[model samples]
Target: MRSSVDIETIFATMAVGLVAVASILMTSAPLGAQDGSRSRPVSLGADDRAAALESVQFALAELGDGASYVWHRGHGKLSGVVQPTQSFVDGKGRVCRHVVVLLSAGEKSRKTEAIACRLENGVWRFDS
Candidate 1:
């Protein structure tokens, strides 16, 4: 049989434990908001949007970094016309959706295609 004092002490310990957990969680909440660098979007879930947008972003990242012609623009948020012939394969085995981007500069409308080199390390380079 426990005395009233024992029950009260138990409840107090439980309450203190709960407060400690809550404090830790509150402190970590901001960390979750930030990436390791504390800059830019974190969350792998955030990195991946819906299928269409994700594919577009992956493609643009390839174009900007891999393609010598077109620097990585992170332009997936914008709209662009992609020719059907566009295709990309990373170095390792990942295949990226290729895009035939049309660069219009004044009188010159130059067309160039970009592909993702399937690098095993997930580093995108210029592919066919």
Candidate 2:
């Protein structure tokens, strides 16, 4: 013999629980399956680049030059080898590192020369 108020309260609680479960399922889904969008760029600071360079260098030292290694950041996976060419200051007054990374993924492969510059927030971004 529950009152009408009790029935309303039970229905409201059930609705909230269902909504919470739906939200959790939605968020837990894989990023790639959610939409038809590509993986976004990941910000690597100077320190991060330096660390990555060290890892690359070590891999190169062990595997020899032109060796390919897999680099994973965020949702993106890049198989490449980083070869440091030089360093220079950009027009924006940021110190940039010039490097050639030979990237290969599946049947696609390309050699890209990129300049990574440090931003004001200490994050390194690709200038070109």
Best by lDDT: 2
The window of 10 residues in a row where model 2 has the poorest summed lDDT is: 16-25
What TM-score fits each model? 0.28, 0.37
Q: Tell me model 1's lDDT, rounded to 2 decimals.
A: 0.33
Tell me the spans in candidate 1 whose CA falls farther than 4 Å from its real position: 1-91, 118-123
What does the lDDT read for residue 15 in candidate 1? 25
Superposition error at 65 for model 2 (Å): 14
Candidate 1 accuracy as TM-score: 0.28
Encode model 1's per-residue lDDT on 1-128: one tens digit a residue: 11112222322343222112112212222223423554332222222223323333454454443343322225332222323244445465576545454322122232334453344666433332
The prediction achieving the highest TM-score against the true structure is 2
- The TM-score obtained by model 2 is 0.37
